[model samples]
Target: MFDHIADAVKLPDLVRIGDNLVVARFETMKVYSALAAVEHLLNTGAVQPGDTLMDSSSGTYAYSLALACHKYGMKCHIVCSTKADPSVVTQLELLGATVEQVPIPPGPMVDKMDLEVRLQRINEILAARRDVYWMQQYHNGFHYHGYREVAALIDREMPGAPLTVVGGVGSGASTGGLATYLRELRPDVELVGIQPYESVTFGSEPVEDPVASISGIGSPVYFANVTYELYDRIHWIAHDQAVAATLALYRDHGIFGGMSSGCCYLAAEWEARQNPDRQFLFIGADTGHRYMSSVYTKHDQAVSLTGLEPRGIRELTELELPWAVMDWNRRPYEVAPKVLPC
Candidate 1:
């Protein structure tokens, strides 16, 4: 019975963009990882049937966890951000998960502050409910293990080639986990992590009450699982760049992917131009359906596509792009986890 949802997480389609680049479209990648993590807990007896599963998510992970809990006959509770798509919240309820939506933080949409408040609220819920088991996606090692197969699948598909894996850095499970496994197979593999402009992940100067338009990637606070050593380079993509790329992707490739995926695509394109000899693989985190209201619908379609044109893409690098880029090795802050009250 567990295999029903567990089996669905394998082998996202690999779509070739041109000669040197490919986008690995994992339509439900987070859902797949969530199922894998939950199955591990169940199989190892870490969690028993009917235990309530609790976690905090911006949006994608909440839906994934809700689906996993539903499949396994467990009750689910989520501390979700108010930024989450209304559709996702509705679906979570439909799947029978209880939800607590945290209001967006005052001042700005600083993801770190928003996340910190969400985590604090999550702990408050956990403190009151001794029976619930927190999935702890941000701190859980099991979350990292779930994406090992994604790395293996990519390695199997492209053998003996120097590869650059590019993707948005979120909880760090998806990109961090994939890089961890891939590096085991090919030590020479390059990793490029992308985050939003104001994200603390890449050591960018903090904006005063900055609001982030993109979700599911970038954090105002550091996640314990985001392995800094695995990255060869890191790039920060801004809201406008992400939006422009997203519109371009839909117009050019017919791929309806979200802002994070757009960020990955733009990074991949830049990397591909730089290393024409190497194969660049970008992980498309999720589809664009959830972004219609926030991203697609709000923009003038023709204007958005036009904004992407003048960048003279082939000549652009991290410096020329709308966002900033930094070598991860030079980051001033230590990538260690901060002690938090659980």
Candidate 2:
């Protein structure tokens, strides 16, 4: 039995979608990251009980950190993006976490600007409050520790299997952390990262998705925690395609997951079809409840999943809209000049 709701929520439900494709689904995947990070901080005396843990989030990490703080008698303060769902903000407040929504700026780069504003606010908060500890989910190495247990679970579940992990690369903790530990057991394990159009994380910044930033998956800013070398391939998906895949996922497989899950599903399904001999695993980062109004309600605009496929390209400059994939070959890109230890 789990000791707390955070413990219960952090565990993923491994569900097989196809004969070779499996999805490690979570209520809020970052609970694992936040729990481990908080525990480590407390043990190391970086933070004490009742000290406020602050972080910037679109939604998922905010909820996870709040739950982690609630479980350990710590306080949580969230500097949220304008894109953060109203439902999530409500939950954060109810959980006793202080919330501040960054103002939506006027421009084409709203997503990027929102993140910059949030980070700026965080800097200001850190300067003023000595008791407030910035969680720095995007840069903290402690965030990666929790996923080692997940890797162990996968190793036990799929012993001696040739695995290709496909998932969204957000702060990079979930996909990067999982692959880092999984590689220790199977050196040949492949990791395919999914990103939304316009996310600078994997060189899709040139192109813009009309409906941009799929919550927790892609980022407008560079994440130090994202170990670029961990990815063997990267796929960029547009908003419409993710919506279609999300709708089809529930209609066909009954897994009601978020936008990141939808994007990962598309990549995983395609990869599974291409390499029938290999096993494919994708991550369902969170449930679709938060995306109901923003994504699910626009089901009429969603396209069919059958005809959809990623256009394979050799260079990052050749990135196109809707969907695209590149063979990253487990090499770090120039954008991430200094590789952070995994």
Which candidate tops TM-score? Answer: 2
Cα deviation of 112 in candidate 2 (Å)?
1.2
Point to the candidate with the largest lDDT: 2
Summarize candidate 1's per-residue lDDT along 44-123 as a digit string, tens digits: 99889999999887577888898888888888999877877778889899989998988866785445566778888877
| Candidate 2 ranges beyond 4 A from true positions | 336-342
lDDT for model 2 comes to 0.87
Q: Write the per-residue lDDT of candidate 2 for residues 231-280, one digit (tens) a residue.
A: 99999999888889898888889999998998899889999999998999
